[model samples]
Target: MPVTTELILARHGEAHCNVAGIVGGEATCTGLTDQGHAQVRRLAVRLDQEHTTAPMSALYTSPRRRTVDTAAHLADQLNLETRVEPALRGLDHGEADGRPWTAIKRRFGGRPQQYPHRPIAAGAETWNAFISRCRAVLRRILDKHEGERVLIAAHGETIEASFALFLPLPLDDTELAGQITGHSCLTRWQRHRNTFGHDVWMLAGHNDTNHLRSPMEVIT
Candidate 1:
């Protein structure tokens, strides 16, 4: 049976901090770059065209500037109001929040994923705690919006979390567990009942960036 309950996750476009090689936590994020805006506009057009056939029921976004900006473009295209979910925000970087990745690496000796059990920085979120919140937020979304096609404009890590939860993949704290989600890429999942009547979430697509492949644009 076809599943009408769909969940689409879109990673926010490139931000200034991304170009500057800094961690874009809530305290440091400055929103999307012009190129990022262009990338998302293309995605919005694609979604708008697809909406004629499979309209989305709701749109959600994290409170970060980059995510909010990405959601704004999507909202305009889909004619849907953007609902902000604090739980959907990216990992809390704590003391590393506005610091350069290079500097942080020099201090911490490796990436945050390298030390999953510990904080990336003072007052930061641990890998375990972060994945737990991600799972909880996704569960809440599925329960509240069952049978409806829902979209979320969120961070790359949030999208990663969805894959971990819905696909029943291990939340690997020691390293990058799955493919890194690209900027403004779309990942889709559909929930359906299996032969035993157990609910299952099937991956429809992952890291889809077809809309950004125009001749005028260069994916970087």
Candidate 2:
């Protein structure tokens, strides 16, 4: 029998790097700001209101501080068991870490890409590596939690990578420029086995945060 899985990927609350307009590599600027905390709270309420019938199965988050902080609010609201999964870590900014996005843009004349896989930045991980890990993480999550509603609190790049994993790889640079997952936004993907028993994945939602129409500053 084939299984169905509902996966929700929520970007972590705004971190210091978000406010400072810097490139936050994996685990850098992991803590949330004051408004960031508020964003999580609002997200929690939204989730509670949403899952009145279609309840969640489990909530997972990256080991990073910001994601952990974001999950904490959700955990409290729903009293759900929250697990820390390292595979959900953010992409590496490499030599660009902690540098302002404006500065990197000026230096690279816009987002530099090594095309097929490599990032133009000297020390950064390849785009190929990032998306590959994203695909692998999805497989791992499915293996353990298939046919369930699962939520993952992670990073913007992780969310983008997840969305991109649905697309064919070795992508053109234009396709590589994916959408931004704003602070505390929710993106969802679903998988179900076909009549032939092959699992097919589909995007149910992306970057949804209308529940947070507040005037607070959000990280893109």
Give the number of the best model, judged by TM-score.
1
Q: How many backbone clashes does candidate 2 have?
A: 0
Compared to the true structure, candidate 1 yields what TM-score? 0.92
lDDT of 2 by residue, 28-98 (tens): 66589988898888888888778888888899888878898899988888779889887787666688877
- For each candidate, what TM-score against the reference? 0.92, 0.82
lDDT of each: 0.86, 0.77
**Native-referenced Cα lDDT, model 1:** 0.86
Give one clash count per candidate, in the order shown.
Answer: 0, 0
For model 2, the local distance difference test gives 0.77
Q: Taking the tens digit of each residue's C-alpha lDDT, what string does model 1 give over 132-158?
A: 898899889878998899999988888
**What is the alpha-carbon RMSD of candidate 2 to the true structure?**
4.3
